[model samples]
Structure formats: C-alpha cells, structure tokens
Target: MRHTDLFYLLALQKVEGVGEINAKKLLSHFGTAEAIFAEKSHKLKKIDRIGSLTVERLKDKSVFEKAEAELRFIEKAHIRAIAFTDKDYPEKLRHCPDSPIVLFSNGNIDLTNRRIISIVGTREITAYGRDFCKDLIATLAPLDPVIVSGFAYGVDITAHLAAIENNLQTVAILAHGLNQIYPKMHKKYMSQVMENGGFMTEFWSSSNPIREQFLQRNRIVAGISEATIVIESAEKGGSLVTASMANDYNRDVFAVPGRISDKYSQGCNNLIKTQKANMLTSAADLVYMLNWDLQQPIKPVQKQLFITLEPDEQKVYDFLNSHGKELLDIIALECSVPVFRLSGILLNMELKGVIRPLPGKLFEVI
Candidate 1:
C-alpha cells in the first residue's frame, strides 16, 4: 500500500469507536479512508452506525499526528503494513469480520498457498503435552504446514521451535508492538524466528503488551489459520479463548484429550464434550479431518527394496497391501492392534515410504 493510503488507515484506527467492523462498514461505503475523512459530518452520520459522536471524533486531527509518527516508525523499522484488502494479506484472516484493518509484519512471511494451523495451549506445559506437541509437528512436517502461535512460554515457544527443527515456517503473533520483545528471556529466539518466519502484530510501535491486548491478540491467532489446536489447558486460559474465537469464525478447532484427573486437560475435555472441537489423537486425525490429502493429489510412494518394518508395522502393511485402500479402524480390527497404537504404527509405515494415507481416513500400500 502507498504511504498515503496507509496513513489514512492508521489515522482511521485512532478514531474513537472506529473498530475493525465499523471501519470496514465505513470503508465499504466511502471506498477509501481519505474519502471518509473528507466527507461532511452530516453525510458520515447518514451511514448506518456512524453516529454523530463518531463523526465528531473523526474531526479530531490529533489522530493524524499519531498516524504520521507511526508511519515514520514503520518505515524506519522496515515493517510491512499489510492491509486487509491486499492480495498479499492472509486469505483466511481477510475473510474474518473482525480482522485488523492493517497488520504490521516483520519477517519473510509468505502465506501464499500454504496450509496454516495454529497450536495454542497453557504456558505451564507438561511432559505429556510437550511430547505430543513436538511429535505432532514432526509427523506433519511432510505436508509442510506453517505453524502459528503466540511467542509465549511453554506450548507456544515449543511449537515454534519444533517447527524450526522440522525446517518449517513458524509465525509468532505478538500482543505488543514489534518494537520490543516480551518475556525478555525470549529475546534470544527473535533473530532465529525472524529468519525462519518472523513476527506479526496489529499493535503499533507505541503499544505495550498489556493484559487486554493479550485477549485481543487471541482472535488474530484463531482467525489467521485454517484450524486451531489446543494441546493442553486448564479450565480457563488464553488457549481456550482462542479456540472459542476459532469456533465463532466457523473454522476447524481441535483439542488433545487428557485424563479427567489431570487439571490441564479440563479445558480440552470440556471443548470436546461440548462438541466445540474435534478430538485430536494424532497428526493423522488433523490431516484426515482437514482433508489436506485431497488438497494436493497424493503421489505414489514407491516401496523401497529390502525395507525392514516392525512386526506390527508389517502386519499393517500386509493388510493394506491386500485390501487395496482401507480405513484405519478396519486395519486395526483386522490386525488386532488398538486404534491408538495403530496410528503410530501407520505413521511409521508412512515414514518408511511403504504405505500412504488417502482421504477419508483410508490407507493403502504404496
């Protein structure tokens, strides 16, 4: 976007009561932010929901001074202000009604035709959640999905690091300005993150990471991806808030189940029990549920000569080889393997290039 256009948008953002939804309505009517400011007060009020008080606020020119300062900071910092309507903006987030008018991004983020998923959970991650989170990213690495998460402690940082280890792009959505990094301890990861994927925020350079901003940031985390996964959470936390926002956006939400006795599992259990999210057991569940296999046609995986498989893996391979393509449940039933254990077995077989998963929860020998 041109500096002029961005200036007006930034100024519009400063106008009192002009939120994303209302700003969208005004922009839709006037066609441009500059036009909205140039229009008469009576004419502005004529537009639905643009009350007299809002028009009066728009007349305040102080917002222009703030916008100019922000613009200078953006240019100096080499930040990219991605307008909602820009082709380069995230397609999924652009469709959201409450998405920011302009997103400030500092990184090599290229969302074009990429499968994006957000993984969020409690800051106090447990051994179970940590292992599951890392394994899930490693398993899904074949598909090359971009991982999105808050750059916080525990699950957030873990997901980001796991993606980096797997050579995948990972985005860190910040609650505060890109001018500073929160937690201070995470400063060391900033350079690595910027090189690998980078940081994004709707907040300006003047903003700080306050309590309310975190709540607002959750919506972007939920809205920016095709799906949101809650690895673990207590009965109440930011991850659940993100999941709720994802549900409201009509996007896919998944939660990893834990034992009822576990405190961290309560949020995920409630989400599943309430039917707000699908139960995610493994990477296969997400792949199958999202039908990612269908997005790109699966290439035939040629089985290598003299490939050794575990006894259980051999059983699955033999069953799939004879049955052509079969559902996971059927293979488990025929091979006498529990579904839980069979998922890992099938994943191993896939990694060995002996078999591949098909759409609709089916697998076949390659």
Candidate 2:
C-alpha cells in the first residue's frame, strides 16, 4: 500500500468508537481513507452507525500525529502493511467482518494458493500431545499446508517447529508489535521462523503483549485458516477460544481426543462430544474434511495377491473389513490396540493395500 494511504488508514483506526466494521463502512462510502477524512461532518453522520459522537472524534487532529509516528516506525522497521483491499492480504481473513483494516507483517511470508490451517492448544503440552503434533505435521507435509499459530510456548511453538522441519511455511500471529518479541526465550527461533514463513500482527509498535491482546489476536489465528485444530487443551484455555471463533466463522474445527482422565484432553473431548468439533486422529482426516487435494497425484497402491499381515495389522484389517469403515479410535478399541501403536499398524496395512484410509480418520478394507 502507498505510504500516504497507509497513513490515513492508521489515522482512521485511531478514531475513537471507530472499529473495523465502522471503519470499513466509512471506507466503503468514501472509497478511500483520505476521502473519509476529507468528507464533511454532516456527510459522515449520514452513514448508518456513524453517530454524532463518532463524527466528533473523527475531527481529532492528534490522531494524525500518532499515525505519522507509526508510519515512521513501520518504514524504519521495513514492515509491510497489508490493507484490506490488497490482493496479498489473507483471503480467509479478508472475508471476516471484523478483520483489521491493516496487517503488519515481516519476513518471507507468502500465502498465494496455499492451504492454511491453525494448530493451537495448551501451553503445558504433554508428551502425547507433542508426539501427535509432530507426527500430524509430518504426515501432512506431503500436502504442504501452511501452518498458522500464536508464537507462544508449547503447542503453538511446537506446531511452528514441526512446520519448519517439514519445509512448510509457518506464520506466527503475534499479540504485540513487530518491534519486540515476547517471552524473550523465543527470540532464538525468530530468525528461523522469519526465513521459513514470518511474523504477522495488527498491533502497532506502541502495543504490548498483554492478556487482552492475546485474546484479540486469537481472531486472526482462527479467521486466517480454513480450519483450526486443537492438539490438546484443559477444560478451559485459549485454544478453545480459537476453536469457538473458527466455528463462528463457519470454518471446520478438529480436536485430538485423549484419555478421559487426562486434564488436557477434557476440552477436546468435550468439543467432540458436544458436536462442536470433529475428532481428529490423523492428517487424513483434515485433508479429507478440507477437500485438500494433493499437489502431486498419488500413486495407486496395488494389492499383493497374497500379502502377509502381522497379527496387529491383521486385527486392524479384520476389524475394518467387518466394520466397512471405522474410525481410528473404534478400531483401536475393538482390536485392543493402543492408538499410538495402532497408527503404525494402520500405516502398514495401508501400504500392503489391504485397507484404505478415509476422511475423518476412518479406514475401510480395500
């Protein structure tokens, strides 16, 4: 965006009582941020939702000073400001009614024709969640989806690392400004993340990573992706908030189930039980649900006429054969195999061409 245009947009944001929705409305009527400022007070008041008080606030000239300072910071820091009208702005997020008018981004970030998904969960990630997240990203590597998450500890950082390891573009939505990194400990990963994908935020340089900022940042994380997956969370956490937001935006939501006794699993289990999210056990579930086609055509697997199956693989195959199509959890339960172990057994069966993986983590006999 042009520097002068960005300057006006920033000033528009500083207008008290003017938010994303109202700002967008004014912009629509006037066609540009400059025009909105140039319009007469009576003309602005004629628009719906633009009350007299808001018109008065729009006359505040101090906002221009703040916008100019922010513009200088953006220029010095080499940050790219993505306006709502920019083709480079995230398409999914752009469609959101409450999306920020401008997004500040840095690094080699690219979202062109990319499949984006957000993975969020508890900060106190457990071994099970970590392994699941790693394996999930690894499996999805073939599809090459862009991973989005908060640049925080635990699940968010784990997801980002997994994406980096797989050579996938990973974007970290910051709760604060680009001028500083939060947690301080994550400063080491910043370089690598910037090289691989980059950092994005709607906050200005003056903003800090406070509690409310994180909550507000969650909307971008949820809205920017086609789907949001909860790896693990307690009965209450920020991941659930993202899931709720994704659902509200009419995007698909998935949750990894865990043992009932595990505190971190309670939230995911509740989401599934309450029909708020689909049960996610494998990358196949997400790919299928999102209707994401593989970039390269998958080679057809030919079944060996007399392939041998190990005892565990035979059990899984037999269960799938009888059930027609069964979820991973159900096959594990009926066949008495641990989920983690069953994953390997199922993969082997799939390689043998005796069973085929279906959407939503279901498997069927070939």
Please report the TM-score between candidate 1 and the true structure: 0.90
lDDT of candidate 2 over 172-200, digit per residue (tens)? 99999999998799999999999999999
Model 2 has an lDDT value of 0.90
Kindly provide the TM-score of model 2 when superposed on the true structure, using C-alpha atoms: 0.88
| Per-model TM values vs. the true structure | 0.90, 0.88
Give the runs in model 2 whose Cα sits over 4 Å from its true position: 294-338, 341-355, 359-366
Tens digit of per-residue lDDT, candidate 1, span 1-366: 998999999999999898999999999999999999999999999988889899999999999999999999999999999999899999999999999999999988989989999999999999999988998998788888999999999999999999999999999999999999997899999988988899999999999999999999999999999999999999999999999999999999999999999999999999999999999987888887997856764555566789998999988888878889999889989999977667777877776778788866888988
Candidate 1 runs further than 4 Å off: 297-345, 348-366
